[model samples]
Target: MSYLYLTILFPLIGFIILAAGRDRLSENVAAIIGVGAVGLSALTTLYAGLDFYQQGGMAYNQNLWTWFNVGGFAPQIGLHLDGLSLLMTGMVTGVGFLIHIFASWYMRGDEYGYARFFSYFNLFVASMLVLVLGDNLALLFLGWEGVGLCSYLLIGYYYVNPANGWAAIKAFTVTRVGDVFLLIALFLLYQQFGTLDTVYIVENAHVVLTDSNLAFWTALMLFLGAAGKSAQIPLQTWLADAMAGPTPVSALIHAATMVTAGVYLTSRTYTVFEMAPQVLQFISITGAVTLLVAGFAALVQTDIKRVLAYSTMSQLGYMFMAVGAEAYQAGLFHMLTHAFFKALLFLSSGAVIIACHHEQNIFKMGGLWKKIPFVFACFVVGGGALAALPFITVGYFSKDAILGAVYAHGQIANLPLYNCLYWTGVAGAFLTSIYTFRLIWLVFFGQEKTHAHPIKGVTYWGPLSILLVLSTGVGALLKAPVEKLLTSAQIPVFAIPESLEHAVHGAEHTAVGIALGGLVIGVILFAFAYNAVKTIANTGFGAGISHIWRTAFGFDALYNIVFVKPFLLLARLLGRDPVDGLWLLVPALVKGGHKFTSYRQTGLLREYASSIGLGVVVLLIVLIITQVGV
Candidate 1:
């Protein structure tokens, strides 16, 4: 019963209590139990993290039991905490608790509120804990699927709506496609390394994968899994549609816990990534492309949460780029900061929506800054952090670290085509700022487009306030330690360019200038466009562009046509028809055999008895003859 186990177990205990007592307990009590469990888990994680830090990055493992032993292979159910898991556990519990608390308020009025909502929320926390704490690949998969199930449950928490249920199914099915590759990659790792333990696999990767190509393919498959979970490239569309869930669930799944699991997996398996540099390059390119695509999509979105959803996808792309560049700590740092601000932004947006009587379209919201001052302030801080507004914000520090990593890779490591990645990342930063501020201006600073309703209670403001503070400070607190931890492995160092240094400071200000330039242009353009298109007739001029943006550059359509349709058709042709034919043949043969057997039956009972007796006599004579011959 070490603190590590307690940190994970507390949430499970809460989940059980809330789930079992759902019918009996009131919504308020259920909320308390759910939030209280996660709050306690957060405290336990903090204590465990402090102990780990005091011990200076040493690894701690607590074995609960032998999970399985067969054919000379044994896997244990255990918890492993190091710098990586410590960071993740803190994020999961801390941010997860806030989301649960927020959900308590957001889901207050719905029927079956306590039973339906908290059950999924608590289960989500428990699944995320298992994901970060598992010591071996098999156990990791269990957590992985657990989180997927919880995600499906939470996304479709309002199952009365068929659309929400469909959205949940879409998410589950898409991610599961990636999960298959993940399972294959794990089996391949075990086949090669003879073990699925993270440490053992990393240490013996060289022995098992003597060929670089094998390692490259294995790592690539694993990255495919990461891509799906992190919502990169072909698998990214589900994240945008995931806005159908409750706002807090969206924040938890998209911003903080489940989405970042892919990047964390890559970081945890850094040595494997190191061995497969080609795979790393592929990851970088995929991330860059996803960033640009999602950024454009975000730019055109009117729904506040959909904008944030696309932003999450874009930010995740940046994270994947960092991981691919071997900037593990930089990526994790961005994740930490992004979690704070993104959650803040969503919760604040939720407040605004609730204040507006559940309206989510930004076009229908304006001049809300006066009505909900606290929420407005929270949005500004969170939005500022997201736009990477100068040195005072968390986004500034974390995003700078990521770009610095890429700059180091290009200038010092002499990695081929690294400069291209560096420039793409810079462009993404600018686009990120533009789209972020566009949402801000449309919702908060614009002309009054809709009448405002008076907001009630501190429930809306409480979570927003807590997150705003964290959004501003988490980066500065963790920056130095993360840097040290990432670089302590004696890996080859990448140097930052002098120009990039100037960019880091204010001396040579091209990057900042570009970012600000994009923001200003986007603000002016969006304001004019939104104002001009106040009526339906004015929107016709850009109808084509609007369609293209709304369709997400037809990526989903292309995937449906190229992959989904063909596979389904082939399944119907080869899988269904042939299998059904075989089944038909078996039944037909059985019918024919029964038809033939019917001829042996006699109408009279005496005839059947005489036949049976004759057959027995014949059998006995044949047996005697066979026995004598033998």
Candidate 2:
């Protein structure tokens, strides 16, 4: 328990080591430090987890120091560990460690900034740890911004590419839109509750807050922040473009760490959301629409990583759907399973990209199954989990749990909209199967369109194989404790009457049928009707629909027209305005003065000595005049 801080310290230390050593450290040493740090953190998490269970699984708080005390408004530098944080910490370190291992191999030939890459990678993991482990909202916000900065650095790791830089900036700017909302929520909470301590806030919110208005606005603000980080709806365009970075960066950010922060935030502040049921319903609706939107977008993406990116958004939508229904355990469980399979899919795609000389368009890739049979197999398992293939995969269990919970909550609470959201989840699952298998078929089973180099190494296959194992039903063993821990901690759940309780199990079966039906249709469309599908896509209406979906239903265009264009126009109009000119003149004069003074800084010792002599002569003459006057 005392070693709780080490989970964050280990990676922070690794970041410093890699950053300071930079190119001086061999790739091998950097790999050891980068991967080993997360591995150690994972091991420490395991140790701490065992002790937590042994010691009765109560929440543990360690206050390192007081962060500040401004007129009695104080937040502490503290860490809190309970069932939720423990689960999040384990996933971050465990899945993150595997991603780091693959990154070492993926980045092998990157001679210029190999160490630099690991430094950013390690820092990202450390920041995520701080985010999940923080004791208060203030500390949580610190970690929140920490991951944001790290994401920017990692996404633009290939700074030589202008598009990559833009993608990174887009990510930073869009997520900041959410961060601003989160900051507002903090201010509103502090204003109402008179403290920024999270435990105190969550425990006493319903008790102290008399007005539902404060709760409603605060929860809504929190959801907006979560929506941005999770890439729901309008903020989602940046995620597809984020594929401009290396595939491992895509996996680490999209699959395991940064994107999931929003889900964690909403779940962490469940009490506040419970008080604002309207905002909760908004969360559920937002999730439903986002899943559908992102699923359609995923169907049209040709880049392998972009396909996975949209898929990540779609799956995150499911987690939000569950959380919005107050099914916290179910959402987190899906997140846990998603971390395993999504990382597997992304890493496998990275391997494929490496094998194919970095060709990413799936249409140009085919018959790679024989060349990289292992990667092909990896995709099958990971894709099965992603599609939530019934009964056999971890995703099926977790996703079915979400569908069940959403349905049960709706039925028990008599909310028609929640039931509608449940159907949306089912529809999202069908799309998941279609696009997932479409990716598998297009990339692996067709005629070989491109040559692929041999992929052979422990680094490449090791993490994939480990994640491959977790993508199976073996990982579903976590279901019991995950549900039990959250429920036992007094997390509120909708009570089901005896007569209506079967709806939960019924929803699970219906979801399975939909998944299987979608899988069969997916195989048929890609295998037997490929040309017909292509012809349809070439038709006017079909092409139009495909284009819209391909551009994520033109949300980007809408934003550009609605937000970007007007803002730019305003800037242009103000660029030479009379009032602006008055302010601009100040800087213009400062520049002119700088140019004049810079002329006197001649780089010569003789000129400098002559200037010193002249200054002394002037000073003596002034002093003599003053003495004569006296």
> Each model's TM-score?
0.88, 0.91
The digit string of per-residue lDDT tens for model 2 on 114-162 reads: 9899999999999999999999998999999999999899888889989
- Winning candidate number (TM-score): 2
lDDT of 1 at 66: 94
Tens-digit lDDT string for candidate 1 (1-630):
276888777778888887788778888888788889899999999888778767876778999999989997888989988767777888899888888778888888777466557877888888888988999988888888988998898888878999999889989999998899899889889888888998777666666777798898789889998888899997887887788888888999987788999998888887787888889888988998898888778877889999889888888888888888887777888998999999999988888888888889997888888877888888889988887877767887777667667666665567757668777877877887888877877788777777777766566667777889877855578777755554543222345567567544442145556777777877766766655544542466577666677677988788889988999989878965786687798889999999988977769899889999999999999999999999
Go through the candidates in order and give each one's C-alpha lDDT.
0.81, 0.90
What's the C-alpha lDDT at position 347 in model 1? 88
Top lDDT hit:
2
Candidate 2 accuracy as TM-score: 0.91
What's the C-alpha lDDT at position 117 in model 2? 93
Find the number of clashing residue pairs for candidate 2. 0
